[model samples]
Target chain A: MENLYDVVIIGAGPAGLAAGLYSARAKMKTLILEKDKAGGQIVTTNEVANYPGSIDDATGPSLVARMVEQAESFGAERKKDEIVKVELQDKIKVVTGEKDVYKAKVVIIATGASPRYLGVPGERELTGKGVSYCATCDADFFTDLEVYVIGGGDTAVEEAMYLTKFARKVTVVHRRDELRAAKSIREKAFNNEKMAFIWDSVVEEIKGDGIVEKLVLKNKKTGEITEIDAPEEDGTFGIFPFVGYIPKSELFKDFLETDKGGYLITDPDMKTAVPGVFAAGDIRHKSLRQVVTAVADGAIAAVQAEKYIENTFEN
Target chain B: MVILEKDNFEEEVLNSKGLVIVDFWSDGCEPCKALMPEVEALAEKYEGKVKFCKLNITKARRLAISQRVMGLPTILLYKDGAKIEEVTKDEAKAANIEAMIEKHI
Candidate 1:
């Protein structure tokens, strides 16, 4: 194959970047392809307290920037291109992007997940007006305004707490009576003075002119409908949804084995059922989806890829 | 792209006699930071035909709200001082922004 790379990693997130760094440092020709931006969902996060050994007040963009620098410094070529097709059944994997095609001995699928939407009416039109998925990005715009968060998971409750720092009041609207978040997170949310909850409810519709003005809610347990309007003076309130994530595995579904949730199924070494192909990060069916675990998966995938190449091709 | 300020916004964007794009952004916004380079590259690509400007909402909050841009990374397309179109948040990708530019230009 002409201009063949030793390894080609999809999605320049933490996992892909780490894989690039390791592979390039091992004298393997590596290329990292990203669709939109280098940083994945983590870029929308403001504080990264969970990642060990991180500097005080480390933000997501800063961490991802350092990772990119490390990867590039190790001679991994990174490009901005969205992959449209992949041929993994052959000895040399073929990856087709919107702009170009690539051939590689090893391919890493690190395309991560995106925030799932409520799919209610007007939700799409009102996005970035008064509806947001990233609290760190849009919370400051709602200062002193009432805000509603939709979801009961750790992300939802934690983001609701983050909203309390800026908004006048924060209310959680969940489909169930009890939150699915951890006990520690739920305890902090209950103790917060500005925090409130609407149990057994889901958003029916989002109403607005040019910005969010009202939200209609329906109780699942009781069939009662409630309308919440923005304050007359503020004229608008914020709605943040953190329900769940949908993995970006549509392109790989036909070629790779995936779980029920559409996440790629991989072994302990991040190898997929197909040879010369691997999956990592939140896109893979894994328990923990943190930055720490993602980078660890990337390192392991790269090392395993090296072994696979040596045994199969170098002979 | 020109760094738009409150003082020059009216002169540069409102009074400018062509297609203008103003990227409304803030400090804590990661998407805004990420989209900046792409917008700048577009600016360079359409340098002679289109005018590109960026406004930091952190500095000009009231200006941004007055224009009804209540979010970060809001890309607004204007023609002859009239606001024509806008794409925000998830829709504010490089491809979409380029399509908008191609549509207006």
Candidate 2:
């Protein structure tokens, strides 16, 4: 088709931006479509430590800004569009954003996942007030306040420990009697004086006025419900849930091979079961979900897309 | 882009003859800072069709309070003199802003 881009990348996080950079560098016509800001979830993060070769004391926004500049400098065009549909059954794929439609030879899916919510009452309304998913973003707001963290996974426990640095006390409320986090992480949480745990329990509701004031917890073993109020003089408390993430793969479910959790399944080369279509970042069914891994996935998907186009259409 | 103040809130936004988008932001709000570039870009693209403006809450706290604005980076879409939609939390996203514009203007 006329004016078809070589690769159209969905989302503008590290993975999508990296793919754009690689595809553009390979002399392919690339366009990166982002539903939100350029940085994705990383923009909410205040600091990043683990990414290799990152500058000392690098912030998440700073890191993402540099990556985006590099990608655009290499000739990747970026646009803001909320994609509503996709037609992936043909050699040349069709992707529809709310504002525009696009045709592409290859499509890279990197619409990253978001943190899973607890689905309890008041949780949604109190999100920015006192409920948060990322401690890195909202921890400082809760300094010296009592906080409750819900989950048993590595991220939950790890974040609980991290919150102790800001909150006066952090109580971990998990569904099971024990934690599912790594042993080392568990040890750190148990030893911390500011950290505590509520076993075999789940939060039934989060109640607050203009801010979070109380939580209703249910003891799974005893079938008892109890109300935990914010400490006197505090008037409100913080609730941080780190249950896990839900992949942003609803639009591609019928077209691409995906795991039960809705994460797109891709080969090691980032190629999906459908030829010329690839998946990357947290949307991919992979182990690590960090900036480093996302960048690597993006690079591979672009290079693979380039090879696919060269072999199929060019020569 | 219009810089909204307490005195011009009515004339520039409410009493305007066209569709208007007023971004209520603060100086140190990181998300607001992150969204300004996108807002500026959209202002250029939507110039003459839709009005884009900003009001610094730090300078116009009374106007912000009068509008019941509880958070930073709140984007309000106004059709003529009536406020139609408000994006309070995820207003930093350009797509979300664009979708609102597409839905109305």
Candidate 3:
């Protein structure tokens, strides 16, 4: 007989860890399955200042460590495995991973989302050397140096603002004349002292030897091309792209309800169209994709999973 | 525990009272995995009042195709055994789902 769990959570991110903590504390046989290491997107981030009630100057890795510790202390069993298939139609949901198969009465999904890249030249080659997608992670490396941010949305602007704290100068490079970020965010960007704009331009090439040293920029309006060089002494600059993110929903595309961008759908209680299966975090379509919100979703999902088990199992 | 088979989905949904939310999902979808908890929470919160269930396309591929589910994490809302609303995966949020339930309930 397969080992049965009261609740099986996918993805060991903030949401999944929170769910595990709640479910395990409730005395449920909770199992959290992660494809890779724990921490999800938070691992990629350098620091987290926005999470309410967070520790002062809490780094992303530190935050994740605390969450993992909390969940484990509550008796949430975690396994590093990738779930390859599922049988959720039955009363006992079956999840199959790369190595084993397990059964659970309830399932919680907190797989989260991944950053989308421009797929332009040198972007992939110079990822860690000078190109980065997370300002929090790479900002400190560019202390007193110049950095360029791509895109014009909320994330792009927000990251640029965050980068300004460390960088000597921060320039936002957008292909559009007007920013697509929220009004308040745009106002902040416009007001920031260290922030500069490269409007109606796109990065045609990210050129560097070992680190990012120069960028070939193309003006969208005038079709003019120019090579922006890194400041002397520093010898290199940083590039952070914040265009958008792609939700990891390809596996469930055939069955689950998804939007054009492939985000998952869930109800207030986190219920999907199917019973016993729930979703939370960045994977679900929502306005805010933050750690605090993901933790809240995990808490709600755990409580709901308990209810689902009681309703289904109790006579 | 209710054992839902392919042949009994319609009967189970129709016989149930209040609202019924169905999740159509498959394996290998990260977003589907992420949304699972929210769906479960909703089902638990409205356990008696609403029917919450998930359909795995990997197991019920024919049914999923019949329903014309083109994407993952598709949520269909049913009230009194009748289809009321359909929400795409990206639009499936607690607030949005609550609004739909409020409209029907």
Candidate 4:
């Protein structure tokens, strides 16, 4: 087939782009298919301090741009198409996108995760009105207003801190008494005067009329419920949820074996159970999900794919 | 696509006749910036049939809120000066916006 590729990676995030850089540099005809524009979830993130070897104040989009440039320089072709189906059992995989179908000797699945919603009432109806997942995207809308952040993880704390810059008061509501974020981030959150915490609590419901007007919070341990109404002057408050993520594995769930959390199961070398099919980045079942680890997974998956192609496809 | 300011928003979108799509964006929103070219391409495709305009929320905060746009990268489809549909955040993908345009136009 004219569209046949040595390796067709299924995303343009950190892992897929890094895989492109590696596999293409190895002289493989690599193609990276992305549903959206490049950068994935990282693009929504503002700061990326923990990425090693990054220069001072490296932003997520800047880092992804460099990665995209490097991958393209190495001759990795990219396309913007959402894959609707995948036939992975055969020797030659057939990936069907909305625009076209592609054949590949080796397929790297790098479809990443998306922000998990709180699933509380009114969250769906008022998503654009007041509830948001991307702080960098919506912070400016809440300038000088009160904002509530949902979650206690790294992203939740970091985003809550970021919201403090725009919102008058930023409060983090966690189901646990203590935060699950890193020590340094926890210390920073504790020290910020504008930041506050609602421990052992979860949002029971978000109430609004045309916009976010009130939030009903329930304490997990004490069984106490409290309702916070929007300030009369402002008429609305912002609710940001950074709780967790849901892997974008809906397309491959039937063909691939995923963990309980829907993360694809992969060996140490990023090889999935299916031959010639590998999974990497946030989609893979791993202990840590970070940019550094995702890039490492991508590099390993590419190298392993090359080895697999040499042994199995060469005849 | 017409870049709208507070002064001419009504003239360009609300008061305009037929179908109109407004891209609610800002300088700091990365997705909004990334989706710009795609939106512009759509504008070129549907040139005379649909009116496409972009508003920077940073410069027109009150106007954006008045239109009930509280999030970034929001695409609102207006028919006869009334908002018929909207997609925001992750739903504001190029394919989805294109589908929205096709459905209304």
Q: Per-residue CA lDDT of candidate 3, range A94-126, in tens?
A: 989987898999989888898898888997767
Model 4 in CAPRI terms: which quality? medium
Instruction: Arrange candidates, best lDDT first.
Output: 4, 1, 2, 3
lDDT of 3 by residue, B13-82 (tens): 7677767888776553345555677678777777787678787655565465345443455677888777
Residue A296, candidate 1: C-alpha displacement in angstroms = 1.5
Q: What is the TM-score of chain A alone in each candidate?
A: 0.96, 0.91, 0.86, 0.98
Model 3 segments more than 4 A misplaced = A46-49, A178-192, A231-235, B1-105
Docking class of 3: incorrect
Cα lDDT of model 2 by residue, A1-315, tens digit: 675899999999899999999999998999999875787777656557779999998877889889899998999999878899999879889999988899999999999998899998998887766787767645655678899999998778877887898789999999999999888889888899999899999999999876788999999999999899988887777899888899999999987888989999999999998889999898999888999999999999999999999998986
B1-105, model 4: which lDDT tens digit per residue?
898999998888888899999999987788898788989999999999999999999878878888999998899999988999988987998888889988978
Candidate 2 lands at a TM-score of: 0.80
Each candidate's chain B TM-score? 0.97, 0.94, 0.83, 0.97
- Model 4, residue B41: distance off in Å is 1.9
* Best by the lDDT measure: 4
Ordered list by TM-score, greatest first: 4, 1, 2, 3
lDDT of 1 by residue, A122-182 (tens): 8998898899998877877888889999999988998999899999999999999899998
Top candidate (TM-score): 4
Clashing pairs in 2: none
C-alpha lDDT of residue A298 in model 3: 96
